[model samples]
Structure formats: C-alpha cells, structure tokens
Target: MSRVPAALTALTMALLLCSGSALAKKDAETGAEPNTQVPAGSRHYAATGFPDRLVASPAQDAARGFSVAWRTDTSVKAPVLEWVLAGDSPDVGTPTRITATTQALTTELGASHHHRADITGLQPDTLYLWRVQGQNTWSAWNQLRTAGRADQPLTLLYFGDTQNKNLSHVSRVMRAGIKAAPDARLSLFAGDLVSGGDGQDDSEWGEWFAAAGWLPQETAVAPAIGNHEYFEEFEDTPQERRVLGRHWPVTFALPRNGVDAADTSTYWFDYQGVRIAVLDGTSALDLGTAKAQAAWLDTVLADNPHPWSIVLLHQPFYSPREGRENTELRDVLLPVVRRHQVDLVLQGHDHTYGRRGEGQGATPQFVVTVAGPKQYRLSDEARATMAPVGEDTQLFQVLKIDPSHLRYEARTVTGRLYDGFELTRGTDGRKQKTELTQGRIAPRDCTRAQTLKGRADRCWE
Candidate 1:
C-alpha cells in the first residue's frame, strides 16, 4: 500500500517471517497444546536463473490441453517451453517450442520472473513430455496426461488446508494422497495452502512446492482460494486493501473464467465428466463479491456440460467448529449448488473432518477435511449436524468416480482408512449414498456424555 513505506514494509515482513518460522515448530499433533518453539532463521527461497517451482495447471477444459508455469531469476533470457508426445521411442517426434509469457513478481526477499506457457490443441488421454528452458539450461522433461471421455473411470486426489508444517508434516499427507491415487487426473485443494497471516511469504510457498516435489509437475493442481491465501494487499498497496497474495496469480496460472472480483480463485475446470467449480468464499465475504459470484456460479452451472459437478471452496456449507458460523456464505452459495445438483462439495478451514447431507440423499454431499498437522476440536453443534467427524489427525481423500457412482475413501497420513462411503446416481439424477465404514478406524472424538458416565470404551483415548 502507498500508505506504508517500502522500508517499513520490508522490516515488518522480515520480522513476521522469523516469527512464523519459529511458530511452525510448535504444532498441534496431539489434542493438547504443544509446548515447543525454537527460533528459526529467516528462510528466503531466493530464485536463480535455473527454473524452479515448475508446476502444471489444468485449463478450462483439461481434456483439450494444459498449462505449465515455472520461476526463474531475471537473468533468464527468452525462456521457452518445449513439448512432444511421449512415445515408445524417446526421440519419436520433433518438439514444438513456445515462448513463455513472463510476469515480474517482487517479494519481500527479492524479485523474480514467473513464466507460463500454455499448451493447447492436444488430444485426450494422451501422454506428453514437456520441459521448460531456464537461463542456459532446461528443466527435466515431465509427464502430463489429459482427461478422457465421460464414461472413463476417473480418480482424483482431494486435500484440505495444508496451511502449516508444510515441509515437516504436510509433505507426508501430500505424497500419501498421490500414492493412494496414482492414476488421479486432477489434484484439487480446498484452500489454505500456506499460513502466512501478514502477507506473502516466499518461504512458505517454497515449502509447499518442496512438499509436493514432482507431484504437481506430473499432475494438474486446482486450488480454491482460502482465507489465508488472502493476505494484506501490500504488494499492490494503497493500504486497507485485503487482496490475495501476489504469489497466487503467477504461481498457478489458473483459468480466468470466473467472476470479475476473484477470477483466478473462483473458476472452474472440466475433466472427463466432472466440472470442478472453484469459489472464493473469502472474497465473497470480504470483498463484497458474494452477489456477483452467486450469479456467476448460477450461470456456470446452468449451462453445465459435465454430468458430475463438484464445487470446491475454502469455507464449508457446514462447519465442524461451533463458532465458524458462515451463515452468509451458506446462504449465498449453498442454494446455487443445490439447485444445479452439484454432486459433491469439498471444503477446508476447520482443521477437522466432517461429512454431512448423507441422509435422504442430498444433491451435493458436503465433506470438510484437513490434511496438515494442525488440529481443532469438534463442537457439539457440529457433531449434531455432521456425522463421522474426526479431529487431531492429518488426512487425505481419494475419490474414484464415474458418471454413475463415486467411491470415496478418507485415509490417514500413514495409509490407514479413516472413513469410507459410496454414492450411486439414480436414474432421475439424485444420488443414494451408502456408508462403507466396515473397516474404518474408530471414531476419534470423546463425547462429554461418555466422559461424564466414565465410559472408557465408548471414546478413543
């Protein structure tokens, strides 16, 4: 913001980064408070000429093609992206080279150029080898595959709120999700990829990248904007503006097909038979974009071409915590998705797991999950509305879906099944869900009644 001086801003950012690094060590692994905090040095992932943070993003229609984005220092001259179909022979065909579009991103540490190259006009279910040119060298070729037809069986990896301990604890959940669903087409995130409270911290973003490693390069990632993603708008500061972190735009290169206020955060992508409509609840509640986003979501779902519509957002229609009463959010976006018969709604920000709307066969099944080390207690109000809730655990979800049915499994970071369910679409479009909790782990919460009655067997210690 012009209201804040550059020197003062940098000093504040440095102090915040140092404090954040220290707080990261004090995690919420157990239900009780963690008593640990060690001072850590400021971690600035300074960029170099060689390309880093290379990620592949899905287009509006992933079946047609995808996009690749990477970061390089300013010295990288004429960065380009080269691509060719993956074939039995390594040198089967000549590569098509495209010059990348560059955007200069200046963080608290320094400045770097983020480049994105869009690859379109490709066939579906095809594998391709793509690489990007750095300053003087080229990144290793990565494999990318497009979505297939509507009837094709699709697997997807869904995560919620890897907002803290990204490198230390969240990395295991990310890799486990990939391992559980190796054939997954799109890796979708509900929100809060980082936990930067003040503003953009390049170090946190770097940890997220390192946690995912080659996962994003191999598969496309679609992120719904969370509350934390929106930090103080100082990068483009005129002060008093709470905009999304500057890293989001150039980092992901998502489709610009949503409402005007939050285009990148609130957009949709079609893969096979699924249309993932991403909404920005933070923008809706904070920036007064609720009315506009509701209308846009109605329009998008009104003309939906995909059979299975899954909506992704940071705030949930139902919260696992009592005080997280997002009545405004639910009032605006809930009816739109329900009216359009959205198959599933994925969400985060509660730091817990909950499943609701399974009774009497609801159109959009609501699921709130957490994938990081942070934990939160489930409230009695939340427990009354939602079922099969879990807290103080890191979890990831793997969904196998087709136009007819969806098989959902929630697994812990150590590859243990925590919750399971299946939803089958009826001929008239309503889905009937069957709880498949035969082999699921015990319910994690210890109820007050069970505790008062001294029923040790009814609760998990």
Candidate 2:
C-alpha cells in the first residue's frame, strides 16, 4: 500500500489544472481544446441597448417560413422584426412587422434580452430584406433568399467545430467559405460552434456573433447539439453532468418539429431539395436520450420528401481519430441511417477531417471536419480510408446539389482544395461518384501537430 502526502497531492492537482488551462490560451495554437470552454469576450454590445448576435435559422419549410433571433440590452423594452420583399423600386414594400418574444438571460456579463421572431407566409424563392428594431436604431437591412422550388439548384456551406478562438482563427475560414459561395442558402454547423455553453457566461456567443459579422443574418443556419453545449452540473462536484446551454434556443429560433422528448435544438428541416436532419448527440450520449433520438431519426428519415438528405450532429458514426470510437452513437443512429439510406452524415466534435462510406444511395458519405484552429490526430482508419483524412489544417466545405447531381469541395482556409467528389444520382437515388483530385493540395501529418509549435496543442492528446 502507498500513501501520498496531502500537500503533494494538492500541488499535483494544481499543476494538472494549470496545464489544462494553458491549452485554452487566447492565442492561436493548434489542436483540440478537449472539451475546454472558450471564455466570453466583452459586454460592450450587450450593454448598448442595441440588437446583436442576429442569426437567421431554417423553419420546417424555409421556402415559406423562417426565424430570426437577436440579443440586446434589457433596457430595450420592445423589439420587433420587420421584413419586405426586395424590389426594383428604391422604396421597399410596406414592411410586415412581427413582435418579438423577448427573454432575459443573466450571465456572468450581466443581464441581456434575447428576442426571437418566427415569420411565415412569405413567397417561396423570393429575396427579402429584414431588420430588427433596437433602442432607437435598426440593424442593417439583411438580405436573405427563401428556399427555392424543389427543382432549383442549391448551394450550402458546411463547417465542422468552430468551438475555440472563434473570432480569431475560425472567422477567416467562414469568410473563405462564404466568399466561395456568396449565395449559399443554409450554413450547416456540425455542432460545438462555441467552446463553452455552460450558461454561466454569454461571451462566447458574443465572439461567435462578432466573428461572423453579418454572415449569420444572411445565410440561415441549422445547428446540432455538441457535448460542449452541455454545462457542468456544478463547479465543486467532481462528476460531470450534461445540461443544455441556456443560450441555445435563445440564440437561434430553430424549428420545433423534432421529437417531443427532446428540445427544439434537435430538429429537421427541408431547404430547397435537401432534407437536413439534425440530432442531439450530446443528449443521446450523456443524458440517456439515445433511444428517443434514434426513434425520432427513424421517423424523420422515413418520411423525408427531398431528393438529397443529410444528417448533422456533433459525434461521428465512424470517427477518424485513432483510439477513439463512438460505437454507442453509431449503434443508435447507423441502423436508422442505413435503413433510410441517408445521403450524408456530417459531424464535428472529433476536431479532424475524415470520411467513410461512399456518397451514394445505400452507402451514405460520413464526414468529420474541423473549421476552428484546433487540430486532432488522424486515425489509422482515416489514413487507410480514401475519404482523404488530414490534420493541422482548418477546413470548410461547399456543396452544390441539383435534381440529379451533387458536387462537393473541401478547401482549407487559405483557399486550397484538399478533397473533392462529385456524385450523379440515378432515378432510384443511387449515385455514381467521381473524384476531383487535380490540383488538390498535399495532406499534412497533423496528428502529431504538437511538435509543430503545438497546433492548439496537438490533437493526438
């Protein structure tokens, strides 16, 4: 039997804590934060009595309906969302107003108001100008296009985890993706958009909003729940529990069509010809909601009406990181995914890029990517798999889907193509694939990134 001194144990624990904190330094290091929470930035806009953090989200049918949510100082008693169709005439049409549902959230930064407005009854595939009322000012008139008809071609931007240093390192990647496709319809985030979601602080949300500037207001976003979206039960308790972040529903007025057992964060919506099915992996993995989510996923996929279907969540069905596997999640969702033959499954959390399965009818493409600066080790499976896995690089994806074909390109923040594929779907939904490797950049062995100035602290950790 061995016994350690109390003072020695205390010193050891302190060193461990300090070492962990170093990984989350504000500077742009590489590697995954490993469930670290990025601290809040400022309260300047929060106390200004003006609306900020404006985000437009997809409705069950974005063609005719959508939602927008914003934050403001609590002093702003009344906040309203107004919209009008874009016209050739300088004078916009008489704007229709929707009073907002404002809720107050008191975080470490103090009290702020969150306003959400779900609007419907608009014409499909139409361009609209919208803004939210602030104290006496209004946010810039944001232009957004509603989902077009089913036969129309569609473009979308997909990013993995932007969970750490959002404003610094992750912002440019977003800018690059948007620059590549200025008219992208929906921005699909695989989860962990922010590093922290414990509800005690709202600053990470601030950074996220500041990072994207006005992008969120233009392209609608569909977010899934990552583990970081869960809050620590208590500081003193050694055991960790999953509590959904208070800012989630307040940040985005997501569709309410998910399973009744889960909250609004886990829902599916159709945009143009695509059916985006999002699940709450954090809740399923930690809160004993696997069966609930699995059942909902089955029903949602079974009745999908769109030609192209994709699933978004935080955890991947087949993780490419070595020594890490989400068998539980795969078990719960894979059967449903395979049964319905989902076209693609997008995930984050692993903070790396890897893909498994062919992008076809029965074999859906399973992809994991990281847009934030954090890097992770690549798994042997990833190296073996040709979905072209890599490390030490931040990436974003642009996907264009039409009636019978889908073209996808994954590029680094510097605008270099890393991996690409084109799929041609037959009448039966089965797709023939073509690889786009010409001019593709070489892959970096980021799995050992810590050695190279330590990518956010090597993902091999």
Candidate 3:
C-alpha cells in the first residue's frame, strides 16, 4: 500500500482528538494561535446556537399532540422553546414556553449536539407558531398544525436520498417540498440521511443535518438506517465495524414501538390514523443482524391497529438500479408488510425516483426518490416495473390519505408534477386505481448508471 501523508494523518488525528469543549475553544480562539481555549463569550451566534432539522408528526388522538427535533452546538447554555397558534396576520400572541437542552460530543469534524421535544396539549387540526433558542441566541418562530382527529384527512411528504450536495443543492429541494405541502403533518426520510461511510467524519453528517435545518425541530421524523450510515470495512477493525449502527438515538426522539432489542431509530409510531413502521435496512442487509430485526418487524406489523400502515427504509427491494436490489429484504420483509396490509413502502438508495405497482387489494406501493444534487440513472427494466421514473435531480412524493382513499403526486425539483395516482378502497371491499396524466419534463440520459451492490459507489457515469 502507498504511504499515507503525515500531514493528512495528523490533521485527522487532531480532529478526532478534539472534544466538543475543545472544538468550542478552537472556534472561540481562532483569531489567535492554537493550543489555547477562548472564553465562552467570544463565540459567534452560530458557534453557540442554530435551529435545525425540524419535522412534525401528525396530530394524534384528539389532534392535541405533535413532535419536533433539532440540533445545536455543545456550548448552548440552555435550549428553550416558545409556541402559539398561527394567525394570518403577523401580530402573534405569546405561547406557552418549554425549556429543553441537548448533549454534545466531538467527531472528526467538530463539536455537535441534538435536541428533540414533543409539544403536547395542542388544539385539533389547528396551526401554531413555534421557535427554539440557546443561551443568548433565538430562532425564528415557525408555524405547524396538529393532527385533527382519527377521521380527519392528512397529507405527508416522503423522500429517498438527500445524501449528496446536502446543504447546498439538496436544501432547495427540501425547502420546495416544505412549501409544496406547507400543512403536511410530517416528512419522512427513507434513509441515506447523510452520505457518511466508514468514517463518520464531519462533512458527512454536517451536510445532512444542514440540509434539514430546523425542519427536524418542527416535525416528527421516522428515519431508517441507510447504507451510507455504515463505514467501509477497511477503515475499522473487523469487530468495530460489526457493532456500528448510528447516532440517531441521540439525534431524534422517536416513539419506542419497534422490537425491544432494536434501538429507538428502528421503531414505529401511530400518528393520527396511520401506523408508520420504520426498519433498519442497512443493519439487516449488511451487519448480519437481520434475524433480530426481522422478528421484531413481524411482531410490530402483527400488532399494528391503525387505518393505514407504511414502512420506510434505506434499501429498495424493487430497485431499478443495477445490482441494487435487496432480495433478502424483499423475501423476508415484504411478506410481513403484505400480510399486515401495509399501504406503502418508501425508500432511497437508487438515487432516482420510481414507484412500483401491486395488482390489487391493499397492495403496497413502493417508492424511491432523491432530493440531493447527486443523481443516478435508472435501469431499463425499471421503467416497466415502476409507474414513473426520473433521473438526475428531483424531489419525490406528497401523499394525502383519508379513510376512503389515498392520493400521491411525484414532483420534480422545479415543482413540476411528474407522476400521480390514487388508491381508493370502497365499502364493497374492492380497491380501484387511477393514474393521472402528468408529462415528464427533464428526464436525463442514463446509459451508464451505476450499479449498486453494497455501500460503495461502483460507477461514475
């Protein structure tokens, strides 16, 4: 093997050694030389605080409860939140205040922290304004709606991979998705939350969170473990890589409805009338820990008692990308999902957008999409298997569900509705499907799309 540059190795080592406090000190004393800790007052606003990664869950039960999550710097004095009902006019009244804070740690990049809190005692289907703060810094207050009730209709946004060009390019797509459904109950990520691999370095995770910003704090997120969350085997000793999963538990406070053995990230939640089940596909597929998760998945599905059931994960079982298919996931997980009458299966890993069809009754619709700038080509056979497919850059789907029917639309980054459909279940126990006539705009060339076999990028084109 070639000799590694000493400077690169030193830089990496120094970054790895710095704790959150040390990183804060480094940021504080940057004007001076190294090896000194600056006073806490010297740090900038962003250095001490920033609101981000907001996601909202649908109003549950009587539409009185919703949740949000975000991240901050370790130096944050105390995390606090204030919220109130939304108004058409700007003169918003004061809201009940809640005080919360997060713990921080250091990685190869620098110091970081995560915060998650559920805002309860809300009015049904009503919009409200909210914001977060740390120390002297305060966040701009945003608005969100709580779930109305069990019989009320609701909309949600679903995405695949936003791992590449996360904060820079992908942010626009995320923002567009937010605007597209300003009242969406929540947004879902089908894994690949970041482009991290092997080394959970700063760039990988920072870009991902930056892409979402305070959206996580504003909404409730159900994140699955994607392949990118894992590192390549070479970076770690064999044993270390085997036990690796994620820091999701520390990031978002999801409902603990999954297998007791699995962590919080791989769990389910009943938001309003929908029972959302999220699985750790990367762990099952790559970590040789499928049995435990599989058994847990079966139990969760068997126990679900909601009007609609949806599953989210990183890998796509009905993949159009070459070598990217998850046969084990399909055989093991799909049957369970089908048996439980799962309404939809959302995923990302192919880096393209597509949806698969089921011939009839309560058949699950499989969708894969990409919100990041990095794009991938789809396989020719994918066109036949999917209702619609898009290459290059694009957002994915916005789904509206009610007791009588389900509607979804797949839009591009430019706000063009590319594909759409509706699934309606009638009183007679028959299911009907209808496809909307949406023309394709900028579908790209995919002659050399990469073939995804494992976690690595296999092709440039």
Candidate 4:
C-alpha cells in the first residue's frame, strides 16, 4: 500500500467529517431531519471557485453554456451540478446532474481547496437555475441568463480595485456597482480583489466571494492578476517558483487565449461583439513574463477579429502616478495593443482613477479605477498623464457596448454618474470619442495623508 501525502491525508479526514455534517442538514421544505452538527472547520457553500471576480454570464461561447466557480471548506467529492433554465416564473426549478471537479491548494495563509463547474447544454439567451451538491447535500440554486447571440450588443461592469475591506465598505462599492449597471451582462475585475498576500487567506477569499454573492456565478467574470495577487517576497527566486500563483486557476475557468506564457488565468475571451484581452502586469515587471507572455499576447491580438478589444491588467501603462507606470509592459505589449487596435485598457494598483487618450490612429483608451476600500492620491505627474483623477475614496465605472457605439460612465458608489463618454466605431475605420454630458467624479482635495493611508488622496494640485 502506498502512503498518502500528509496534506492529502489531512484534507481527506477533514472532508469525511464535513460530509457527515452535510448529511445532517434537513431539506428545509422536505422537513427530513438529521442528527449531526456541522463539523469543525467546515461550512456549507456553493463553491463557485473557478473565476473569482469576473463573470462571463452572457458568454458568447456555446448557445447557453455559461461557467461558474466557488470554494469549499474541505476536499469535496466529485462536483455534480444540477441546473434548469429559469423562465418567467422564478419558482421554476429542476436540476440535471453534471460532472465537475476540484483541486487542492495552499494560499498565502494556509491550505485551501476550490471547485469549478462549467454548465453547458442549454438554449441561447435564456436564464438557468443552478446549484452545487457535495456529500449528498446541495446548495441553493441561483438564477443566471445566457448571451443573446454574436450580433447582440451587451453591457459590462469594470471597477478599479476591490482589494480592501472586502466584506464591508468594499462590498458596498461592488453592490453599488452591480446596482448601477443592473442589466450589465458581465464584469471585469482588474486585479486587487483582496490585499494579495494577506487577502489570500481562506476566510478573506471567502469574504470576497460572499461580497460578490451569486454575481460571479450568475454573470461571467474575468479577473486579472494584480500585484496584490502575489506574496511579499524578496529575491528568493526558488521560493517564488515554489509559490506559483494560487486560487486563480482553481477558482475560474477562463478562455485560454490571452498571454499563454502565463497561466490560463491571464487569458482573453470574446462575448457577443467584444474581444477582452487580459495581461499580467505583475508577471511582466518582476517575473519572466515579458518573454513568454509577450509572444503569446502578440499572436492572440494579431489573430483576434472581434470588433472591440479591451485589455485588462493590474498596473497602469499610462498612470497618474508617474513613478508607478509600467514601462516594461508598455514597451512590450503597448505596440501589440496599438497594432491590433485595442479599444480599452482597464487596470488597478495605484488605487487612483485615470483615463488617457492613446496617440494618433490608435483606438485604445486607458483607464485606472479603484474598486476596493483603499484609495491613493494623484501626484502632479500622475495628473499630467490623466484627465480627471479620482483621488478620494468613492469611484467605479460601467461600460455599455451597443452595435452603434460604446458608452462609458464613471460613478460614485451610490449610483451617481460623474464622468461619461461614447466611442463610436464606424465603417470609416476610426473610433470617434464623444464626451457625454456628465459632471466630473474627482475626489475632494480636503483629504490628508493619514486618513488616506490605504486609500488615495487629492494631491493632483
């Protein structure tokens, strides 16, 4: 008999204890009671572990094939998801079991596990009710809708950074972001979902999921690996190699198209009429990302034919913070984006908000936003690069892409539109930008260094 690895043995013991407890929770409506308590170190959850913050709800892949992911307290049994299309009646429910899988991992804080289930085989542009089941106990099925077809126009949500106070203030920002774009087809998380090393803890990751709720499950999500996604390391290359990026791939199954040199986590996918390219700025700057990822990115962009291309990453190529600009990534990837006519670049890390117009003949527009509780100040150099900077605490953005034009709006957490613009791409082969009739959403200058420690302040003047 072969001996089991210590980690596997520990996880198995934990899972068995958890399964016994799951068998005890009586079906609320069924009223069938069980006799055991939830095991120690275990919690019942939906475990949408695949993609963390981004949702590909109206995914343009198969007719009605949408994907979802979550985490679990222990090593779970085989993933068997049951789903049925949701109709006019919310009560409509029926579940067909689909096979899924789980992967073991150790996050920054400790050991952890996640599960991802891709639900396919459904009608086009329709809603579906789905839930996860492990150890014979199932999670509540949630409502999700598929994409309207390739030619259909769609709306998506883009936030700056959601890395601070995940469950409290940051959650409000996310909820407000969701409410602001109630009909948004999907969301793009441009890194900083948590504080990176500190946020990699099992509970912090859970808080992030709890904050997003069924959003990531219902809507399709695409997340970028930010600086916070990595641990605090010195010059230990071997240690860094041993600590390969975590929780990302196991949490969301993204389309494998972006920078292949990196993990599938940093990839791109097209939904409806838009092409989204995800880049790994952190890897490119510190790791050996420039060589491998750059080549893959060039190929992906060159081959893409989507009408609009948006690149997402953690660091800003053009920033309000002059010192923080990613020159290396800019040198390697910017030309690709320009050559491929990339439409937008969304990023976070400086914690401030910014937008800069790409040079002549280029359609790519750059934006930096803060989705988390933390914020930063826009220095004079940072302000020189960007137009209106959001240095104070509250900000987010919503992007609506239609057949005629693409609309972008920057808003406060409470649903007030501060900045707005429209990008109209016509047969003339030029994307004309129109500034909308909205007030600026810049942060007040009254903030001080102490109060804005983790957040950005109003230092642009």
lDDT of each: 0.81, 0.79, 0.66, 0.66
Cα lDDT tens digits for candidate 4, 1-461: 55677667567456644544454332223453222122234443223333233233323363458766555545454667678767677666566777767677753224445566677667767877777765545667677766666677787888777776577666787788888788876788888676644222444566677778767766767778777666644336655442334666676766654555676547766666677778888778887677677677777778666677788888888777545657888788787877777888888888777778776643677888887756566778766766666666567788988666888888888777667788998886578888776565444443565441122243311
Total backbone collisions, model 1: 3
How does model 4 score by TM-score?
0.81
Writing each residue's lDDT as its tens digit, candidate 2 over 130-196 gives 9998898889888899999989999999999988777778889999999999889889888888866
Full-model lDDT, candidate 2: 0.79
Which lDDT value does model 2 have at 108?
52
Name the candidate that leads on lDDT.
Answer: 1
In model 1, residue pairs whose N, Cα or C atoms come closer than 3 Å (at least 3 residues apart or on different chains), thus clashing, are 1-237, 1-238, 2-237
Q: On a 0 to 100 scale, what is the lDDT of residue 380 in model 3?
A: 75
Question: Whose TM-score is greatest here?
Answer: 1
Q: What TM-score, over all chains together, does every model reach?
A: 0.89, 0.88, 0.78, 0.81
Which residue runs does candidate 3 get wrong by more than 4 Å?
A: 1-62, 84-97, 197-205, 213-219, 232-247, 359-362, 380-384, 438-444, 447-461
lDDT of 3 by residue, 44-107 (tens): 2123356654444433332676655566777764577778888887788867787665666555
* Candidate 4 local Cα displacement, residue 100, angstroms: 0.9
